[model samples]
Target: MTDKKQPRTPGAELPDHPKFLWDSPEPKRSYDVVIVGGGGHGLATAHYLVKNHGITNVAVVERGWLAGGNMARNTTIIRSNYLWDESAGIYEHALKLWEGLEDDLEYPILFSQRGVLNLAHTLQDVRDSRRRVEANKLNGVDAEWVDAATVKEICPLVNISADIRYPVLGATYQPRAGIAKHDYVAWGFARKAAEAGVHLIQDTEVTGFLTDGDRVTGIRTNRGDIAAGRVALAAAGHTSVLTDSLGIRVPIQSHPLQALVSELLEPVHPTVVMSNAVHVYVSQAHKGELVMGAGVDSYNGYGQRGAFHIIERQMAAAVELFPVFARAHLLRTWAGIVDVTPDASPIVGVTPYENLFLNCGWGTGGFKATPGLGEAYAHTVATGEPHPLIAPFSLDRFVTGRLVDEHGAAAVAH
Candidate 1:
């Protein structure tokens, strides 16, 4: 098949869109708030900073194209069914924003709350699921426990029969948990942020931080060093690398997380099915491809490609969970770096450096918490104080021995 290349100029008209963000690659000389990494978090931070705080003097510096990071590389899963109250507060806030993100952004994000079912195979898994479900309800997060029959009914493709190994005994069902189009989210935020006069500088890499004593004054970029009153690092997987450049260390380990899609088929999955015991989660996109993935690679590395055995194990679990998918052919596979913390929870909030904020350590659950974390992190950078919703997620928590443990809840059991 011969492919036709679309031509473009330095300042040419972008392909059809209601509004454009990055018309040119020019980076602003200075800004009040410089957000590094123009993915979902960075773009959303710019949008909220302008919309809520009226901070239009902001710039989002991206090393590559917009949303081309983990934002586009994720499985597009969105949920807030975490175990701890801290995790719930941050992620549930994101879910709330996700509920009305379409209207808020004035774009169709394809936010589908088709429910997410986490299957419990072992007794320990059942107990944890029940505890989490109850905790979710108590915390005002919608969740419940459903039997295997209900799981089968909710997701007809799931094989809940006891005849199978690691049979589904029950599931923690989050009715509002679902998926969204990840690319549209980044574009919507970028467009809105641009409309508010926030600059979206693409292909601009932040090489180092310009600091005054302990305070971060601006960023040193390949294009040119730009001054800023405050700098918010929303680089996700690359957060450590950026912070390390400034000799600011945090307990964040980067890992490679992989995901793939199956060939287009008739919709077999109506909702998300996550099996914790088996270590696989599957969701059918509107295009009929079964989007699925599992845990991160065991080793710590910056490489975006995960070990092949990870996907191999996930495929076994996929076939075991839904025999119908045994014949389904896998399509393309890709990976993105995830920054995992010691507790399997994120580290967000202010850093030791004055006027420099940190929003990393999201690990595998970052996509679901983008909107909420963006708003909270923006608030942190806006008012120079941590947002109450995310105050517990501060980096100080690690040193203070107040870790919010969510290893089972936040990992890629989806």
Candidate 2:
């Protein structure tokens, strides 16, 4: 129930944390736009609101420290191999932005394109993986189906022998998929947005909305009521809590998702690997620690921690798959609240209120879609219309029965 203060890497020196990136400014009485949540998504949205839409009057309000929530907790796996076309459209756009994000932000994000392998254990897994590969190909996203032998060659640490339970049959390979320094990504966005004269308001909790006849005129924060021409909700897991006060029911359920890291070791994991059947995905950090994660908890709650049983099962599957990780020491474990939808897809676009926009239900894909969602959602909020890439992800999709169900497809469930 407690974590001891231990060294990040045994007998090795670690650098000091970077200097403060952005200023914490007081909220103004009014602005052109106000974005709730100061995590990666909200910061990215603010950046694009200035760069893409030429809207500089923006404020990103965060209750806690910026990027201290899921942005800091996720395992940092970035990929665009989803089975659905709508997912491909938005995520692939984000991946393209990720490719040039460092240059765009003028910061070092350490975005490594090491690659990713989604292992298939059963016959059905192989079939579904192959189908997803083809779907990704049709969407112009780089992907290929590889046999178990290829999986072993790509990651020698993997135990592909048939003697082990749920032996690896094959996998879906995406060479462009990789991981990045998540904290740096968030800071880069925040810094850029701040330089553009946008306000980064921290420690300001939004209690409710200031509405006039169903039009959201502004937000009521603990500090004061800040007026806005438009409001966008990028408040990930706690989005439902904000919308609930207005009686706008979104099809979202919040759950706790956990991830852990091992004590720093020599570089062994060269690429990211994931398994839906075994309920574990893993990669190695730039600092040489093995990073791993699991699925969401079954229950719905706002807590930022998960049950220990989930961690136990995650480690069991991880050891059987890698074998080399069996002796590694668990460095630390933490969790984040994720807002999931019934179809396992995101909700982005117009809301019942004319001046209000909604962007949530991204679940585990929020980190990967940060830039793309920000750009598209900024356009939607500025122009009062959905962006072409995010049109299919509108809130009305649930009523129209046009859900982009990645859960049923078992494609990139992480």
Candidate 3:
């Protein structure tokens, strides 16, 4: 899967017959799989279905252009140093996949293993950080505890105070974690899936599902109806709406998470830094822009845009940590809607519906887990059984009161 060189600004208008979608008005035939949402998860699922499971009759339907959802809107941070074994293990595999995404997809995703440092500012924060490091190690992840001096050595720009509102203590470092090119990741999956004969239907929204009793027979899209043996709801923010159309209630809330990028400058920040006390995280992009992100919206909403207060607070935190950023100009800011669940982890695998699969509730961590989630989800769709990597993320957990909570470490933006 060699990545072909594309134009700098890629989206050109297609011909009367788009190469991305099916040419016919509406196919009277049925597909083996119909995946909703053309984001990372959806495209990745399509690729795995064809490449791994040998299922080629698949179509990915998106309301907007491909990868135009949270996949294009994320900060592109990839990490696996979570506070639980299940999360750490799954995401660690995701990180490994990212390491070779460029070669595997033959696409230049520009993955950089610059490392991630989760800082501690209070006693409780230090305790939690240690616990997370231990948990990550227990899960076979290389997470290490580093002191304030080591943090300074890694990122000299950080303002480590011994006596402040919340004094800086130490940090947990994960060298395997880093960042990747977000748009390239989306495009990589799209191109590979398209090459593998999966229909990438953009601007085709799934209005409702065609269900026979408890089983989903197909999907009803704005363009036309397409029958499918299995339907995967990879729609992140709109999961609730689609599930509700099928009379299924998902315990997920859509919230807006804001991120801003500063004007490109000489690269200074090397490692991803997250502060639990301030609920903020900052990293420098490959283009030298400082990307900063914070917690979700104060109130839940379907709106992707966020208030100015979130940016203001994030800027304050950035300047507090590294005063040099005070002089840096903010080039642009954007927000994405995250489908948050009670435990801040994703919900993957089968739902109450017989042939309907779910891969939503990613919150803010979906971008990193794109490959692994898609691979595992494709297995679930092909065999009608949850993969071992994603068995813990089933929808039944909410019903059985057995949630895989990662709130202690995931409270801050990843």
Candidate 4:
């Protein structure tokens, strides 16, 4: 916070007044809590752990640089319009957090609330969209069903005519839904957590767990063994690896989710448009580049890439939707491994292993949930109890037969 009494100008501010990251010297050998990943959720978990619970003696150990994983890789669309009450509750909470995240972090997260349009192509699609919109409203999440003409008004580039294959019959529009800068979200939390005395050790891989009986005491990292009173796994797709090492299994299959961007051009698309029928989603970044992607690769792999035919199909769908982009030069393409769960919901709660908490199974919806996920995870880690916001997503839900399946309302392909 700046002092009103102090004389300060925009360009004449004092030197070293703001630091983005804490130049952490070294691993302190032990910490009160150790977060196993340095992605958005992991860093935010540490931030809330300090800010809310006053648990400052924390360590966020990453195998690579912070947010180099799915945090930086996914399309940054944010929305909470879901079909289920449980899904709507958690995602709506995240939306509320996103509404104030920039001010809360003292940083510009570049969150643009242009809107999001989920296009409907078939009768079933229209039905599902209407049902979801009603459910979203019932759950107090803002959403509405808009006809094809309204869809055209929202995103003029979308081909909503009946002549096209999988023609748009209607759409579910959420006015508050939009995109943000992914890296800024991660770094914002990182800066805040670091400033709060959370140790962020990058390039440190966790080789194994240091356990006593069923309780995990610490972790055995490539850097060395570091002791911790408790540990939480926020390691996105890599959750499988960690659980496999612990000899327990979570029903998560990792798949490569890919996205591409076109060369910078004049702004045309004002809102995010998603077509589940065609399996393609598109949005224009603040810089005017067309940020686009379709569905995941059919095969399961951690290769962090897409099959040639899959991307080719995605491009075909994109061009079909936006014929104006047919000549747009491709700038870049990238991918990240998404951990798909049996129920398509996240698992964020206590595990069978004592003193070890699990936070994974978000699949393609993880990036949109950075803040609320972190808050719930921090509360769980601090109190050794699942926060109400995340209690329904426990691993036990798979066996208990309660699933927050939201295939109609989530992911990179929307």
Candidate 4 per-residue lDDT, tens place, 193-303, comes to: 888888999999998899999999999999999999999998988887888989978899888889888898776788888988788899888677888887777678888
The candidate that wins on TM-score is 2
Stretches of model 1 off by over 4 angstroms after superposition: 1-21
TM-score of 2: 0.95
Q: Give the TM-score of each candidate.
A: 0.94, 0.95, 0.93, 0.94
Query: Where does candidate 1 have its weakest 10-residue lDDT segment?
Result: 1-10
lDDT of 1 by residue, 1-414 (tens): 112112121233323565454454477778999999988999999999988899999989989888998998998888888888988888898998888888899876767788889889989988989999989888898899999999888888888888888978999998888888788788888888888888888888989999899999999999889999999998887888888888888889988888888998775578888876788899887667888898888888878775668889989989999998999999888888888888888787888899999988888888888899889988999999999998988888877899888888766643
Scored by CA lDDT, what does every candidate get?
A: 0.84, 0.87, 0.83, 0.85
Ranking the candidates on lDDT from highest down gives 2, 4, 1, 3
Best by lDDT: 2
Off by over 4 Å in 3: 1-28
Scored against the true structure, residue 390 in model 4 reaches a CA lDDT of 93
Roughly what TM-score does model 1 have, to 2 decimal places? 0.94
Candidate 4 Cα misplacement greater than 4 A, ranges: 1-20, 410-414
- Tens digit per residue, CA lDDT, model 2, 1-414: 112112123234433546876788878999999999999999999999999989999999999999998899888888888889998999899989888898999886777787889999999988888999999999999999999999999999999999887899999998888888898899899999999999999999999999999899999999989999999999988998999999999989998888889998887888889988787888888888899887888888878775689889989989988998999999889889889988888999999997999999989889988888989988898899999999999999889898888894333344
Q: Please state every model's RMSD to the true fold in angstroms.
A: 6.6, 5.1, 4.6, 4.9
- Clashes counted in candidate 3 amount to 3
